[model samples]
Target chain A: MSQKQEPRRKPGRPKAGTDQPDARDAILDQAEFCFAAAGFAGASLRDIATRAGVNQALLRYYFGSKQDLFDAVFRRRGGMISGRRHVLLDRALAEAEPTVETLVRAYLRPQWEMKQSGPGGAAFIALQARVHAEPEAHALDLRREVYDPSLKRYIDALSGLLPAIPRDLVATRMAFLVGAYLFMLNDLGRLADLSEGQIREIPPDDMLEQLVRFLSAGLLAPAI
Target chain B: MSQKQEPRRKPGRPKAGTDQPDARDAILDQAEFCFAAAGFAGASLRDIATRAGVNQALLRYYFGSKQDLFDAVFRRRGGMISGRRHVLLDRALAEAEPTVETLVRAYLRPQWEMKQSGPGGAAFIALQARVHAEPEAHALDLRREVYDPSLKRYIDALSGLLPAIPRDLVATRMAFLVGAYLFMLNDLGRLADLSEGQIREIPPDDMLEQLVRFLSAGLLAPAI
Candidate 1:
């Protein structure tokens, strides 16, 4: 599948230059849209190529296969989000005493900010929600590849803030926090409809503060 | 679209009898599996009919159309869950002071119970998660038909319990609670994987208690 010796390679196309990386980025962009809209099983490579305005040959050459392309799209944004979380966590750690609120904010704020990162960010958030409902195999794959390590780091931070809480309970609370965050992010509009437009009126920053308080309390709740 | 005068109706079937309702139930069972496995757009009427062991004509005779069938599947369970919530809330209200814990447990425990009811219960929960990731039009349709009224009733009860919390914040916290519950239910296995087998050890009843405690704390968190 390597394109190194393939005769199909176009000559004189600005060899190893700016446009080559742009092409890869464009393919990832369209793939993110397709995968987000249709999911891993439903998205078609042909349709993705057509949407990206690239030929199928070049698409495969760049990303190798459909699953590989999906991983690439997932990693592209997943890596960015993970990087942001680390920076936020570092800032929280520098505080005199990083309370549960600071750690919770560190975990939640980067994702909230993702909503403002433009259409790609929004698409990725939607895609992550869809990924949750994916079949067990794909869900496990993403969990291992993208989510597990980053989640562990955050959970460790949460546990560090609440040493008296049992480690397992700390993990459970963190899991609950993530579930709430992802679910709310995807269902913000539905919440609006259910709450008579009241939820929609709360600005994102205010919502984040509300979430931090709610989650911090949950994490610090007395053991049952 | 009316089937009132269709020759497709099979005679000799006991009219207004036990066998008639069984056929509708069978179709719904199959449709739930298909929709949960493949989503609304991915699942087809023909496949559902085949899996149900009924003719396509009979399927249409019972359910009218694809969208109508989806709505029926949604309403079948949505109605039952709503009914259970009403019962739980009524009982909780009978107490001298229904703690936030009681109200939150009333809202959450029934859905957890559904997971053990049968295959239908599990499928409906999965379908509900998938529905959150569906197109806005379909998600909105479900919110209007099944979710909005029931959620409002529960939120009102929670607000009544926590009178000091602003009404809008009450709704927001309830929204967060539902998000967390749905996300956790769908990702139980993922949680196990992320927590390195720690989460898998918690029994369902224990998990429910943990969820109730976490959510009750969230609901009662002081308004930011």
Candidate 2:
């Protein structure tokens, strides 16, 4: 929770020559931490500003309001993850025949990689899981805007592979896949405790393989 | 969020014989709602008291502290769900050979029935999902205490069925099954949106069937 090390400026004012990009990034990062720790309704602008070593006025200037700031935090990482998903999907489709496993891997790997990338990425993973629990007013638009199109692409690709399964069932299973992956991403030591340290350390690649295999089987299950 | 009406009393005082059990149940219900909407760090005792139509002092008198109240909320429904799971498991094991589907259904149906039971049950489902996203200090003990024993029973049963899969891998897939079921439990309109009205309404029984099928396939997948 340490603030960035730099010379302090007036609390409400951003100097014209200051690195505005750094300030904005810092605000989003701290906002993600706060929003993830306490949910959207619980996180305060003052707390986020203080954690970022900036002032509330600067946050307002950069992001307009708390809601706007939340949307920004989501868009910053949600957009990036969605973008990566599309790229992965493109390469998978271009490289070889897209089996359910290939499509599942393509959809899941980007988020897995992002979660392992750094603290900020991990915070976003937690925040994304929290988003599903949020009230519709707060979460619906953000979800539709940030994730729907990319998710639709994956769902369609999955449908293409499982032609016997209805598209709606495919969509339903896609939602299940998301739940499984998000839980694994923010497991918070459940696996270690559950396994009693027997499987304490799973390499990221192997973990991803397990997820893909489980989900691929699920997505390919016969329609009932 | 309307408070239940019987008769208004002094804000800070509980009547000597005014249905103490009812008051305690009311407090647990509203507390579940608040904690589900706001994370443990974000939910306030004052808000919960107000929502329950009691005062903060009564909450303190009954539950000791906010953490204690949270644990109570979890234990109330969590204990019930786990209890139901054990019953189902017993019946499954005695009535027939415990196939993966039967074990999966035994583990999953209790929570599904609870979610479909009433608003109080649904609130607890949301609260349970939010529990995983909570910090370790808030979530760890409750999860281990309320859920681990029943979950371990199911994991062992599944391992007994799938002798080829390692026990730790079985544990990991159990975690995945939890995530999938929880997400499906609190889908929050994602399925309708994802399906674009094509599958707007699914019967609860059918939804549970789909979940059981998906997870059975996942849990029974060949070890990677």
Candidate 3:
């Protein structure tokens, strides 16, 4: 790692600044962990600072406040769905006439891959789970404040491919499917004996098959 | 209603034994509500007792500790599903055979309408959501203490119905379905706006139809 650049510290006798890990990263890391474990309202700035091993007061100086810190964390390193999906879009579009299984896999695999191998990745995944529990906490706000538009783009893209299902039904089902993705990503590997890499091998194809079976049969209008 | 043969706590002085609302039920009700809102580790017995209008000391007298209280709420609504129908055996048994719609509604509605519509129903529903969030909190202990053997009977019943799907696949699909049910319930109306009497108009058949149409097609096992 390149030598860390010193973040500007407020003027002080001790040249006051983070005495431990880089204050900004440390705060973000701690906030993510706490949000993942205890949820947003269930945790506080004091709790994050203590875990980050810094003066609680410095947390405010570094991140402005807890909500701002949360926003920064939400915006951290490719966390939001804001940029550069041309490759994913091209692939999904290429399969515009894809089977249900193929389509489901296309939608879910990106989120699953994002969950791999990072410090904040797992914690952010957990924070996402926490947001699901207390949705009023941040799910919509983060969506709006960040990249909901990109998400809509993806959803609209999927809908184009799934013309048979009613749009509203598709929207609701998509919401639930996304919930499943976030839930499984947050805890499935840890809760089960499987490793992250291990669960990855389940073949998105097989999962896609199951999702197709579910949606086609699940929401078909009452013409049993 | 027959008056107690023995004079109960007089109205003015009020008997300590079992008054208007006995301490135990009050505690359970309040604890379930608190646990639903605050989660297992997050809620305090004092808050539960306060909400119940019982003294906090009585909480200790009844349940010992907060974890004990947590366990109590999950176990409180025991016998929600007593056992599976042994005769439900002879049906055409394939995950495909039940038709996606039948399976989807069957998998979901139990969690939806499977409980008593009493004061604790909403709170009980919330309890399930918490369990989904932190399955570890209830897993080993609840498995030992609360998992009804009848659940296997029901899964077996499903297995018998969905013979084409592998056993493990059925189980995983069921797991995701359970996750979907709880997440949607947390977000969607606890009960659909239709009144209980009006709900009869939307029979199990129609509900199942909606589920199968949507989920079956969306989540089908990908065709090779």
Q: How well does each candidate reproduce the native contacts, as fnat?
A: 0.62, 0.68, 0.28
Task: Name the best candidate (by DockQ).
Answer: 2
DockQ numbers for every candidate? 0.49, 0.64, 0.24
Full-model lDDT for every candidate: 0.80, 0.85, 0.57
Question: Fraction of true contacts reproduced, model 2?
Answer: 0.68
lDDT of 3 by residue, A11-61 (tens): 554544636446668888888877666655567878888898777888788
| Deviating ranges (above 4 Å) for candidate 2 | A1-21, A197-201, B1-21
lDDT per residue, candidate 2, A111-175, as tens digits?
98888899899889989988876555668678889989999998888788888998888888898
Candidate 3: Cα lDDT at B9: 32
lDDT by residue (tens digit), candidate 1, A57-162: 7778988978889888988888788888888888888888888898888888778888668888888988888877765586658746776676788888877777
**What is the C-alpha lDDT profile of model 1 across B1-224, one tens digit per residue?**
87677465455555675554587788999999898888877788889988886787777898898888988898889888888988898899998988889888888878898877888899888998887776457666875677677678888887777878877788888878987898778766556655655545777679889989999888888876
Candidate 1 residues lying further than 4 Å off, grouped into runs, are: A1-21, A197-200, B1-21, B197-199
Model 1 residue B173 CA deviation in Å: 1.0
DockQ for candidate 3, C-alpha atoms: 0.24
TM-score for each candidate, following the candidate numbering: 0.87, 0.91, 0.72
Which runs of model 3 end up more than 4 angstroms from their true locations? Answer: A1-21, A41-47, A64-79, A82-87, A94-103, A135-148, A190-224, B1-19, B78-104, B114-119, B135-151, B189-209, B216-224
Residue B205 of model 1, lDDT score: 71
Task: Mark the 10 consecutive residues where model 3 chain A has the least summed lDDT.
Answer: A191-200
